[model samples]
Target: MAVSRETEPPAGAAELFGETWTQAQRYADLLSTWGVDRGMIGPREVPRLWDRHLLNCVVVTPRLPQGVTVADVGTGAGLPGLVWAIARPDIQMTLVEPLLRRVSFLEEVVADLGLENVVISRSRAEDQAGQFDVVTARAVAALDKLTTWCWPLVAPGGVLLAMKGRSAPEEVEAARPMLRRLGVSDVRIETYGDLAVPTTVVELTR
Candidate 1:
């Protein structure tokens, strides 16, 4: 439905809906309507997106630098990208999804949210200009291939964050050579939350 009744506060463990429960309900309705209209989510997937998808994305989002520009590669349905935009309104975002249909869905979501600083690019992540401070992808492809696909879109001194299920240490090691080849040298992992399958955030830096 609406946005989550949740947000990680500056100094607290976490807060239930930064604003209010009613506001959360409103956001839930907004997102559900948008998801339904754009076909970004199916009727059954709504609950999952609200919990495991959207909330999961925002839960780990505080890990990033505030107000930084970010791009979401292979943003199929704009989970973390759109969720990030909603959580941190000041952070500029580009959702780079090569599929025109998905880009169209992103466009609708941006318009519905009235997000002024967001854009949808119909191009592969690697082909885009290296302009964003952070590049992110959520369960898009295998970590090894995804590393090569998204690393080039990151600005130097910036980072690429891969949101994954289960541990990606082996994937990170497997992707090390690809990372080095793509100029993403330092690879590290940060795991967080009590997910049934833990969420691992793979950070790639130059």
Candidate 2:
């Protein structure tokens, strides 16, 4: 990892989120800036970008395999994928979104950040193959559906760093049959409360 500063978020949040709210805020600002430019959101709603978007994405970052290549499936505004790319920069990332408008925003962000390790793909994750070490899905689907869409993209020994809610355990239980068939095991949960929307990181190793 490149040497990085310990820019912690607001006090309590640092405990839960591991970054200063300022960092999340900056991410929000960037997202909002793009949202406004694209007309995806009104200016007023931009202020809530941190609460509604950035924080939601950051909560899932900790679950990713450190320094591994990652793919963000259904990267609608490039949440954890874009944020993680900005945060780590050490990990190579592919941000896949089917929407052209969002892809335009992602392209702008990547260019603005000079992110050498990132690529914005205007395609479905399932449509691409053998290009990533880790796969990520944030609020993308029920575990069963998510696996069907994303698990195949992960290489053996890699994982799916998926986000889930409070009922994650049950989601995992419900996804067991599919998980087994997909050659995935070791479903683990990681919690983050610093986000305005609390989340659970549900990891499945392939």
Candidate 3:
């Protein structure tokens, strides 16, 4: 599958992404190659790497607080994690993935992007120690399972930002009991980007 460059960044992306837009484009190219070679991403996904993957990930930038530490759980091929690092240089991003191949890919991408604020960890969320201001994941698991894996990594007063699909409301309702049990102080669903295909995020505050 050939990677397509026909897809440009969404309007106003240059102002939002600033100098990092070029780096994001390079990262998208890498994802088309390394992400597919290692089976982390499907060949069919190459065409949508810009809008569906990179831009979708970057849309979450406005929601993040400045200079916070973020632990991206199950960061396969560094989806939103690496993209976030590229878009926001102030935050410290840890791309956590258990598989060696994914870890290697993430490490190389980090180096290739020269992202000094990024770190790649080959470990599951539950096994990882230390908490972060923001714990994030994209397409990793369902809401209930995601809570189990990610909640522990959220520091006191921190938040878990799980990038969900159209099922964001349903998942929040389904996970209400678990959220209560886990002492989640608040829960809300936020939508970002185009209204037609906005990115839905389930925000769980601890």
Candidate 4:
């Protein structure tokens, strides 16, 4: 599945991505091809891989503090995990997925892209030890369950940046009790990217 020029970065991409724009394009192409064939992404998703996936994932980069250790939980095909690694070389990223197939694919992509800052962990978030400065997830689970799984991996004063949809606020409301019990000090909803297609993120600080 070759990437179409129409799906390439938008006009302001270079300004936002700088020299990494070309690398991001290559990553997009790889996702469209290997990502679909491996069943990590649907065939219909191929056409919008650049905007719907890669760009949407990279938009979260700005919210992260510099030089942090990041854990991407349930990283199916490495959404913001691999994408963030491509966008911000300063961060060390750990891609955590339980499925062997997805882990294999992530390992291959990491090797193929020569992403030294990224590591593949074939384990679920609950089984994984060690804390990270930032924990990221996309389409992983509901806010309540997600926090249960990911919160343990967040270091003291670290944060969990969950890429959510329009129901972010509602999820926060429903997860309020869990947040309080888990010692979450702060929570907020932030929107990023173009107005036409923004990415909603729920941030929880521990």
Question: What is the clash count for each candidate, in the order shown?
Answer: 9, 6, 0, 0
Model 3, global lDDT: 0.86
Q: Compared with the true structure, what per-residue lDDT tens digits does model 1 show for residues 30-138? A: 5566656667666566545455675677677677787899998988787678777766767888888888877877786677657777888899876887578999999
Candidate order, TM-score descending? 4, 3, 1, 2
What TM value does model 4 have?
0.94
Alpha-carbon RMSD of each model: 4.9, 6.9, 1.7, 2.2
- Using lDDT as the measure, the top candidate is 4
Question: Which digits, one per residue and each the tens of the lDDT, describe model 3 over residues 46-67?
Answer: 7777778877888899899999
Q: What is the lDDT of candidate 4?
A: 0.88
- Residue 79 lDDT in candidate 4: 95
Shift in Å, residue 76, candidate 2 = 0.6
Indicate the worst ten consecutive residues by lDDT in candidate 3: 1-10
Q: Which stretches of candidate 1 lie above 4 Å from their native place?
A: 1-39, 194-198
Whole-model Cα lDDT of every candidate shown, in order: 0.72, 0.72, 0.86, 0.88
TM-score of each: 0.81, 0.79, 0.94, 0.94
Q: Quick one: ranking by lDDT, best first? A: 4, 3, 2, 1
TM-score, candidate 1, is: 0.81
